[model samples]
Target: MSAGRAQAFWLRNLTAKIAAIPMILTSLVIFIGCSIWTVVYSFTSSRSLPVTDFVGFRQYERLFGAHRWSLAVENIAIYGVLTLVFALTVGFILAALLDQKIRFESIFRTIFLYPYAMSFIVTGVVWQWMFNPGLGIQHFVRQLGFENFTFDLISNRNTVIYAIAIAGIWQITGFAMVLMLAGLRAVDDQIWKASRVDGIPAWKTYVMIIIPMMRGVFVTSLVIIAAGIVKLYDLVVAMTNGGPGFASDVPAMYVYNWLFERANLGHAMAASTMMLLTVLIIMVPWFYMEYGRKNKN
Candidate 1:
């Protein structure tokens, strides 16, 4: 390209670029800068104050060796897996059902999507009450006829993770359904018509044709849900408070407790760095496949 063309290229969309400068700078200073600062401090022996006394990997070693941290890791793993599986399955099913031209479709869609409008904290609190053995499902069931029924999953260490998963799924499934429904709506009418003409069953068409074509939608939903799983903290705080002896503890909560409660900044930063790496591990390849490859092509 000529010097003039290169100059023009640089000057292209100058106004829009100028408008975006604030946000661009904000991201650099906040996200990137803060991330680097945290990673650097993670190597130190910083307590309540930010210090420069480097301790190598002692903080990391301690973080991994801590029983609470280990339990948090295990809990998050189980919660993340179950949340992704059930959220995708239930959301897709609900989306498929809504795709059918049923009566009161708008009403059904609104009902399904309503839960997602509320904050996770609110959802957690509501579900917390519902899970209470004395006041929630157990009591309701006993009042009916099954007086022996016991639904105290939230208070049990082994079962508390499942309770957290339940609230997480309820709050998120609606968002997933909306995304899948949008993907379903984007499918061409001719594809369905052709499938019908070919005498292909609806379920078969969805499984073989529709789903395969909604790859972008599926990936988008997966990334969103995965990010939520990694940053899970507020719901656990509002619902279980890592209660029943730290049974429902997650990595985010662990980070918070170390940073604020215990005044162990270095320890918290180490854990936060680990969470960041974990998110990047899941996201880097996804970004490459979704956008990097497209740019290359």
Candidate 2:
């Protein structure tokens, strides 16, 4: 296109463009600018505040060597893996069930999605009480005459990570269900009719035909869930506070404590940079495959 035509096209949407300026500037300054600043300061030897005393990976070396950081990495890995698997599986199953044109489907969707409307902090607080031995499930079970029953996963260091995973799953699974349900509803009606005419079992058709057709939805849901797993912090704070001797600490919590509680600027930046790198590692390939391939085609 010529410059005149390009200018005309741009001017056609001038009002919309003007409306978007604030959001565009905010992304450029706050997101991209702060990210670059964080990466640059990660190499410094700053203690309480940012400084230019270059240390060249010294902070990262200390971050890796710290047992607390190592434990945090392990806890996050466990929590991420468990939450990713259960949330996707359970959410998809719920979506499939709801797609059957069941009774009061709208009410069921609302019931399932209500928890997701609540903030993570609220969900965490509610689950914390639900996990409490004296006040929650265990107490209720004991009241039913099962006095020897034990459901104190939150207090046990070894099982606290699982409790956090369960809470995270409960909060996000409904959102995943909504995504999957949209995908399911988008399936061509003729395809189902064809399957019925061919006498194909519904389960077999779903597994062998319908699932393969929803690749875009599955990929979108996968990325969203994985991103959540990477930056997990709020739920851990409200639920466990990295307690029971730091057994449930995650990378985000580690970075926060180092930055504020320990006053270690460089170290905290290094951890945060590492997190940013992990997210990039996961996202770059997906972006390449999803958008780059489309552009190429």
User: Root-mean-square deviation of each candidate, in angstroms?
Assistant: 2.9, 3.1
Model 2: lDDT of residue 176: 90
The deviation in Å at residue 60 for candidate 2 is 0.8
* Model 1: per-residue Cα lDDT over 70-105, one tens digit each: 999999999999999989989999999999998998
Report the C-alpha lDDT of model 2 over 145-194, residue by residue, as the tens digit. 99999999999999999999999999889989999999999999999999
Query: Which 10-residue span in candidate 1 carries the lowest summed lDDT?
Result: 288-297
Q: Each model's C-alpha lDDT? A: 0.93, 0.92
- Best-fitting candidate, measured by lDDT? 1
- Deviating ranges (above 4 Å) for candidate 2: 1-21
What is the C-alpha local distance difference test score of candidate 1? 0.93
lDDT of 2 at 49: 83
For model 1, the stretches where C-alpha displacement exceeds 4 angstroms are 1-19
The TM-score, computed over Cα atoms with residue i paired to residue i, of candidate 1 is 0.93
